[model samples]
Target: MTTQPPHASGANGAAIDLQHVTIAYHRRVVCDDISLSVAAGSFTVLVGANGCGKSTLLKAVAGTVPVAAGTVTVEGRPRRAWGRRELARRVGLLPQSNVAPEGILVRDLVARGRHPYRSALQRWSRADDSAVDEALAATGLTAVADEAVDRLSGGQRQRAWLAMLLAQRSEIMLLDEPTTYLDIAHQHELLELLGRLHAEGRTIVAVLHDLNQAARYASDVLVVAGGRVVAAGRPAEVLTAQVVEEAFGVRCRVGTDPVSGTPVFFTESVPGAGG
Candidate 1:
């Protein structure tokens, strides 16, 4: 049975909501009293320095980590109330690192996303096949659908993983540093693709290390520090120089991006600073 709080409706019809959530490992609290929400069809970015509980928070939202206190809800339904397959069909998660099975074809790797939709008696259906094909095409991997996942380049591999998530066709996507380990061009490409996905009415919430990139693509920014949300608002309103310095412990200047008018950060090296 699920325990639901009264008055749980979220702002702007949020797809995911974390209410006073606290997570601990070995009795040491990692995240404390964290509360946030991801609105439907919105692009929300989680930004913080290393070891600030960004990844842990995302894991909690994905149901991969147990919360020590508080509740997580999807469309006002408690996470524990949803079965594994049901949750998989509504929410998809992409971790920072994924190990592809050796010699698995790209198409087969993506097909794993359909597991939630299948049963022991019912095999792949026409809709499943079409979802796979559309996912491959959306990620520009239709040509390499037959290639070995291990043989693909880093950028291609990232796209393949994205294709897998796309095949799930979930309304909410929780991504952990999806642009990690990619070149600058690929990073931009991946973020742009996420922007397009948001425009198409998918709710996207991601933990990103690149503040400038987050500002460029995210409609809302959640700035975290010391396991607490320091600011959450429009990119221009939440990503000030003061927030950057406080969160990152670095001197920086925040400016608007010439192309997008989003907030951008530039670090300054003090004179006589030594590594």
Candidate 2:
């Protein structure tokens, strides 16, 4: 059984909402009393130091990790209230790493993402096939769709995983370090793909380690420090020098991106180090 209030696909309401959410593993709290709302169609990035609970908070929103306290909702309904398939249809998550079966073909791996829409009685439909094909094409893997996933280069493999997420066709996407092992070119490619998706109005919430990249692409930035939100707002407002230093314990100078006019910063361990 499932109750639907509003679809997560628009700019109407919060795509994902965490209200005083606390997440812990084995009684060790990672995020405590964290409250934030990801507006629908917003490209939001979570930034912080390693082990600062950015991924933990994202997992909580995705319902992958159990929330120790408070509530998490997608489209104004409690996460637990949604059926598993319903939840999958509403939100998709891409973790930092995913290991596919060594011999599995890229197309087959991407087909797995459509499982949420299938059941015992219902089999593969043209819609599902089309979705898989579209996802592959969108990720530039159409030519290599039949190739073994393990044989692909790191960037190709990352695109394969992303193709699977695209095949899921969820309105809200939660990504944990989506650019993990890619080279600079691949990273920019992936970011451009994300930009296209955001333009199509899917909510994108990602955990990113690159402050300048996040500022360039994200509509909103959330700075997490010591398991709590230190700042949240537009890139210019949230990615200031003080906030960056507070979240990462690093000195930085903020500047505008020449092309995008977004806030870009250069970090320094010592004063005038970049000079």
- For TM-score, the strongest prediction is 2
Residues 1-275 of candidate 1: C-alpha lDDT, one tens digit per residue? 11112222345487888899999989988899999887777899999989899989888878999999999988778999989999888889999889999999999999998998999999788988888998898888999999999999988998899899988887788999999778999888789888888877778899999988998999999998999888998999988888888888888888878998878889985435798
The clash count for each model shown is 0, 0
Q: Looking at model 2, which ten-residue stretch has the lowest summed lDDT?
A: 1-10
Q: What is the lDDT of residue 240 in candidate 2?
A: 87
> 1-275, model 2: which lDDT tens digit per residue?
01123445323478888889888899998999999888888999999999999988878877889998999988888999989898888889999879998799999999998988999899799989988999999899999999999999988999999999999998888899999889999899999989888888888999999998998899999999999998999999888889888888889889888899998888777544575
**Pairs with backbone N, CA or C atoms under 3 Å apart (clashes), candidate 1:** none
Q: Show model 2 residue runs off by greater than 4 Å.
A: 1-12, 270-275
Question: What overall lDDT goes with each candidate model?
Answer: 0.87, 0.88
